[model samples]
Every structure is written in structure tokens, then in C-alpha cells.
Target: MLPDTLDITAIRADFPILSREVNGHPFVYLDSGATSQKPRQVLDAERAFVENFTSAVHRGAHTVAGEATELFEDARARIARFVGVGADEIVWTSNATEGINLIAYGMSNASLGRGGQAAERFRLGAGDEIVVTEAEHHANLVPWQELAARTGATLRVIGLEDDGRLRLDEAAAIIGPRTKVVAFAHVSNVLGTVNPVSSLVDLAHAAGALVVLDACQSAPHLALNLGALDVDFAVFSGHKMLGPTGVGVLYGRAELLNALPPFLTGGSMITTVTLTETEYLPAPARFEAGTQRVSQAIGLAAAVDYLDAVGLGAIEAHEEALGGRLLDGLGAIPGVRVLGPTHGAERVGLASFVVDGIHSHDVGQFLDDRGIAVRVGHHCAQPVHRRFGVTATTRISTYLYNTADEVDAAVQAVADSRAFFGVDR
Candidate 1:
């Protein structure tokens, strides 16, 4: 439950981009899963960094550089607190894709004997098994696939049930003695399904395998406490959380991060540089090599602050209402079939569906003409699409700024698309 005075109308006013028009109609942004629109706070924070305190961080002696470094570290601390992890465990990556690749590449380095004992724990070898699920986004799936190919390890996937939910019963049988790693999504970006993470984490731990969570969708929509989840590592994109692009957060257990070797190494991540011999810095800094996204990090911290002020729980409740409304409206349309669980009970605000006789691209283009923005494609989880027996789908995802009326508009536009294509009554 949430407070009655959530004031969603006021919340929608904060995003300036929402006021724009498309094709002679007001914009209806239902593609939040692709990327959320930035709030004024996040935008102003980035601008302020460039205008007032722009300097190279962690490698300069000047006043501006010191101030910049202080701001950067402070932002790190803020994000750490938001995710319920220690500041030292948070590493800034380019995006969730880079974060997942970091772990995959680190394990590959260890397997090649480039890293010491700390990294060896992560190393996958012949006969070792890496477990993932069919519902995983490619960011979570492809990295482990490449890692398996590199280390000669076998990759296993937990299949989805008939209703598009994870088949945990099958997972129990698959994650066995040889399993070294289990990576999956906390929430399905296309399906909007909330995974049973705690149970999955316990199962992976029982098999002595480390768990990595793709929290790209969940972190922005749900209340996340990584410490309580007991995951070894989790990754999420800043752009999807109302923050600026080119910045993401990787949360790893402090001990595990300290043990794993650096993924990208060069300038600024080293202790002392020499031609032949150089030692790396500690966990977070060592993982973040070269120049970092300083301003974007600061802006992300502001975005976190903004979300906190609005209250994550309230946002969740609001989005849940929107999800229910959207689901009901879409269900009323003939020839429309939602890909994931039809009920909104265990799902978020995102929903992907296919029309009986229209191509997804045609559906999307028709919606665009009516000023409704929706994602049209596989949404990067091709296996899930395959599970649903479709090559692609039209996804309508919502956020705090979305309204019940907008959901109605999107549903009407979808219905109009069907009629325009002569595929419906």
C-alpha cells in the first residue's frame, strides 16, 4: 500500500520531455524499459558539474580537481547507500552490458593464468557449468556464453514454463555439483516478470556457485537491497533509472570484488606504474580503469536522491496500478496476446504483446502516428521471444510519470493499429 496523496500529476510535470508533441499529438511515452526520461534534477546536476566544477579527478593537485574528486567519491557513497552496499564495492561501468562483460572477462583472465589466487576463484574451466535462464536479456546471456566458449565450460539454461515464468523445478535439477556461476535477471525487461531471487540465490549457494543479478529493470522500479539479497554481484544501467546515459553501477560483495582481478587496466587504476611492473589499486578503482564518466556519476547520484524523495515504495505502487490498468485495457482488445504472465500480480509496468495478423513493426509505426511511443522488437531477449513463439513483440512499458489515461490511449492506439491493418473487427 502507498500514501493516498502520491501526486502523480505533479510528478509528471517534472519531466520536460513529456510535454513535447509527436505527429500532431501529445507524446505518450510507454517505452520506459528501453530508457527512462530524465528529470530536471538529474539534468541540472550534470549541467552544474560542467559549469561550476569541471576537472580531472583522482590525478590532480589543483583546487578544482580536488573538489571534483570529492564530489565524485561522494556520489559513489550516495549510490552505495541507495543499494545497501559499502562504498568500496560499487564500480562505475559504461552500462550494464559492460558490467556483465567485466565479470566474464575477469573470469576469462583467471582461467588463462593471468590473475593470481583471488581471481582463480572466479575462473571457469573444463567441465564447469554456468547456469542461466531462457528469460535472460542478452546482456546476461551472451557474456556467460562467451565465457563458456573461452573456458571450455558448458553453459546450461533454465527453461521457461508454459506461462513464461521461470521453471524453478527444472532449475533445481540443472544447478548441480559442477555449476560454478548462476546469472539471471531480477526482473524480465520484456515480460515484466519479477523473479524469485531469494529462492534462486539460496539454490545457487547450496550448489557452491556464485550468483550475479541483472538488476537493470528492477533497480529503477523496485526497492533493492543487495546486502539482504546476498548476491555476489549485480549490475544496472543509469539511463533506465532517470539518470544520464553512459553510466552504470556494478555492486559486488566487498570480499568478492577484492578477490577478483581488474577487468580493464591502464591509467589511474594502478598503485605504482613502471614499464615492466605495476600493481593495481583496490577493488572499485582497480575495476574502473582509464577516464571515468565523472559528470554522469554525479547526475546519477542526483537521480537517486530524486527517487528517494518521491519514495520508491510509492513509485512501485503507482506503477503497479498503471500496470493493472494497461493490462486490462490491452486484454479488452481483440487479437492481442501478451507474451508474459497475463496477470499483473507478479509483474511490473512493462508488457510485451503480439497482434494476430500484423507485424510488430507495423504495429509500432501505427502507434507512432498516434503519438504513442512503444518498443517494437525482441527487446533484446530473443530466447524469451522464441519461448513465446514470436520473433518480436510490441512492448508498452510505464514509469512514475505515466497515467491511467495514457494507458487507455496506448490501448486505443493499438486497437486502431489492428483495424488500420484490417486484422481485427
Candidate 2:
């Protein structure tokens, strides 16, 4: 469902990068799935924080330290509200990749008898299983594989159907008594498939397994409520959500987070330290070791505010409509094969496709030559492409800043690339 209307011109003006020209053509950025172009407001926020409140947080008692601490935690509170979680539930991470690793390593610690009885449920052993999907990004998949390697647990996978949807039947059979964790993507970065979270949640819960969501894609595009989803843990990157690159969010159910062991240990994450032994702090702080990403957090908060001001529903509507245009236009081009979700299916704001008789890099170069920025290659989800029987693809992704005209231009570029490479011949 889209809003009544959106002013594409006015929305595009907020982002300074849209005005950029490439190869003598006006820039048409279609790679938001890889990294979104930042708005001036977010950039200014980062600059303002560094220029003004450049002190370390949670350490000093001085005025500057207090100011920095307040701003940092305030950013957490703001970002927490945007995703419908409590501030304490959100732990700062270097990026979503790190966030997922935190959970996996924390659980590994539990398996090794680190967190005592509090983390017993997180432990996995010989016959135990950790389940993922064929549609997961490597961030969500690889860490679990490493965790399984560390703990002697078996790794199980839910297969994907022909249309790129997860096989719930396979999920029912694969996730059973031994399954200790079930992690999957809220939306496939490659497929644009909005997964049926509730059904998966029910299955995991019924099996007494913890559910971890890779929400790096969903957090920016959808109105997220981690608490409402009842997920045990979730991870999303700030950069993907219109924020800074060095910061990401790891959201855990408060109780679970408190019981979990810290992944990276250092300065501020401890409650008490001695030569003999050390006691760690609780949740957010427990996980946020060392000096925090103060300036980056503030910039992310500003991005959150900007997104809120634009209204997620409106953004969703805008992206959905543009996604429709992307799919329709790309589908119309000869030799272009959309990798996921067929025509008229519900999709988010991205598309990945392959053109017959042309390498994906050649297709990307042709598009790049026309000033359309797209993501080419495996997109960090090799399993998904392998599931679709392709090694790589050309991906066009959208955000609120994108327009239908740009989508058309990208489609035209794809068509032109096909002709230029003689793909249609």
C-alpha cells in the first residue's frame, strides 16, 4: 500500500549525491542495497557532534564527557524507538556483520560454560542443530557455520523453492528437538522477498529454538518492531539504513542479552575488574566494549529522524511503486532474467537479474557507463545465487531518494547493454 502521493523531486533534493554526474551523464544511483547515499542532514549531524561533543562516553565525569555520553545514549534511544525496541535492547556494533557475530560468539561462549546457568539455553552440543536458510546473506550464514564448528553442533538449512521463497515444509522437518537456534533474513537482499516471519517464529518457538533475524534489509525499508516480531535477536547495519558506516545495531531481548556473555571485552563493558577476575556489565553496555561510535551514532539518529519525518509508510509506498517499475522495466528487456519473485508478486525495493550471453560485469560496465550505479556479482549471498543457478547477477536496489524516472533509465540502460553486448542476438 502506497501513500496518496510523493514529490520525487523534493525528496531527491535532500540527498546531495543525486546531483552528481558520472561519465558525463547525470547520476542514477540504484545500489542502495549495497550502501545508501547519505543525506546532507546526516552528514551535518556527524560534523556537529565531532566539532562540539568530541569527548569519550561512560568514562569521564567532566562536562564534555557527560555531554558526549548523553548524546551517544540519546542516539541509542532514538534509534531504538525507530525499530520499536527499548534502548537497553540495542547494542552498538561496528556493522551488522559484527552484530550477528556477537550473538554467535556469545552463544559459543555459553556452549563452553562461560555464562553459567543463565546462558545454558544458548549452548549447543554434538547432536544439536542450528538452522539457517538458502536465502541468507553470508553475514547471517557464515557466523552460524563457524559457531557450529566451534560447538560441535550440526548446521541445517531450509531450502528455497523455485520462486525464491523459503521451504516451510523443509523448515518443519529440519528444525526439530535438537535445533537450538534458527536465524534467517527478514528480507533477502538479493530476492526482495519479505519472509513470513510469524510462521517461522511459530515453528522456532514450537521447537524451543531461539530466533535470530538478519534485519539489515528490513530495518530501513519496513516499519520494524522486533519486540512485536518476538524475535530473540536481530541485527541491522546503520549504513544500510541511511546512517554512518562504522555503526550498526544488535537488538536482543533484554533478558537474553543480559544472560549472554560479551563477545569483545575491553574498557567500558565491565562492571568490575581486578588482576584475578572481572565482572561484565549488563546488555547494551556489556556488548558495547571499548569507546563507542559516538559521532556515528548521532549521525544515525539524525538519519532515523529524517526517515521518520518522511514517514516509513510513505517510503514503503514509494519504494514499492518504484520496485514495481524496476521489475516491470527489467522484465520487459530482452535477455534479462529476474532472479527472484516473478511478476505481480510482493517485493521490496530491489531486483537482481542476469542477462543471457553477457557476463554480469559486462552488463554492470554498460550500465555504469550510462551513469546508473548498480551492484554487480554475488552480493555477499553466494548461496542464494547458487540456489538460482547463477554465480553472479546485476542488482538494482532503491530507497526513498530514488524516482520512477531513474528506474526507467536503469531499465533502458539494461536494454541498451543487452543490445550493445549483442545479448539479444
Candidate 2 global lDDT: 0.91
The local distance difference test score of each candidate is 0.91, 0.91
Q: What is candidate 1's lDDT per residue for 1-425, written digit by digit as tens?
A: 22363687788889998999999999999998999999999999999998999999998999999999999999999999999999999999999999999999988888988668777788889999999999999999999999999999999999988777899999999998899999999999988899999989999999999999999999999999999999999999999999999999999998888778778989989899878988988889989898889999999999999989998999898888888888888899889999788773498998899999999999999999989999999998899999889999999999988888898899988988877898876
Per-prediction TM-score to the true structure, in the order listed = 0.98, 0.98
TM-score of 2: 0.98
Question: Candidate 1: lDDT of 413?
Answer: 89
Worst 10-residue stretch by lDDT in candidate 1? 1-10
Worst 10 residues of 2 by lDDT: 1-10
